[model samples]
Target: MTAEGKILPIVIHGDPVLHNRASEVEEINDDIRQLVADMHVTQEAARGVGLAAPQVGAGLRIFTWEFEHTGDAPTKGEVLNPVLTLLGKVSQEDPDPDSETEGCLSVPALGYPLKRSAHVRLQGFDVDGKLIDFEAHDWFARILQHEFDHLNATLYVNRLNPRWSKRWKKELRKQGWTTAGNTWMPGDDEDPFGHDAEAANEAEES
Candidate 1:
């Protein structure tokens, strides 16, 4: 996203960036809230629609997203903790078989096709940390997954097309992620993706 104003460039694998466990969120104050806003700005600036705090190095289980969904009566704009809103009502109505494409602010320029439940129920809170829930189906589901992965220290490539996953490897390496000091290599049984996104992200999380 916006690299200016603390919108940090997404850190990729092997940079000692993605490989650390994120700190649990204990307080949600102006600084935390500002970080969320900064993440959104960075996400947009990176041409991605979603971002997470850990991806920016804060290592918190938080992220944000904006999406375009096709379902029921057309609810618009960005909504967090959508379980309290129309995001969960999608299953009640016919949605145009949701198919979606997404990219992450941290996994910069890595776009891929990801199939999700299309309908989701997410619970979190606002800037003030009030409990909130929201839901959405189809396209919104895809967007939600992309952003949520950041919170879990996962990435879009974990569930996206393998071919795209391969592309992302190149992108990751292009961003300075390589197998060189890796604790395990591709052929190793512990290495996932056969050493792809699955193993890579797992490595980071571990």
Candidate 2:
């Protein structure tokens, strides 16, 4: 892999690439390795724990993750064409908003609660085609599930409870995000979750 990778623009929620299942990577090659490298860079640039290939406009089954809040040492790696196994039953009830909240880079600025399995196992190939088998729990498991869903053309918002899902759709419409071609550059664009200082002050005064 190259020592450095370029940051790629992130596609938004309405992009067709995000809605279509990604094709498996048939061969591990320099290009695939480069894409993995760039995905890591993009994930970090967006301050996200994980990112999928489709989020970057590539219709390939791949994802990269770097998270340090799993109550253990930081976990970081890339998985290609992953197969996920849930270790425990996922609760069907609405998730607790305080603890189960999730945010997606594609959705930008929004967060909502969604239920997910607490334990999971993922098997996949690394960038070099080596086998990768591991288990994840807590937030790490959530991250894995979130990225895996991307490979299957599902987003977290799509998995939200009906109430939250409707709200999310309304927000998407308000922001004009229901069509394709929306994108954001990491370093060049305004912070996705950053609040405008003036707006904040005005709200506070009001």
Best by TM-score: 2
lDDT of 2 by residue, 36-106 (tens): 98999998888789999999999999999998754443388899889999998899887999999999999
Compare the candidates by lDDT and give the number of the best one: 2
Specify the poorest-scoring 10-residue window by lDDT in model 1: 184-193
Model 1, range 1-206, lDDT digits (tens) per residue? 31233455565545344545456667766677677677666655554555666666667767666656565422322323323223433233222223355554444334566555656666766555666465666666666665665555566666545665677667666667553232222122222223246546899999
Backbone clashes in model 1? 24
- In order, the Cα lDDT scores of the candidates are 0.54, 0.90
Error of 1 at 45 (Å): 2.9
The C-alpha TM-scores of every prediction are 0.61, 0.91
Worst 10 residues of 2 by lDDT: 67-76
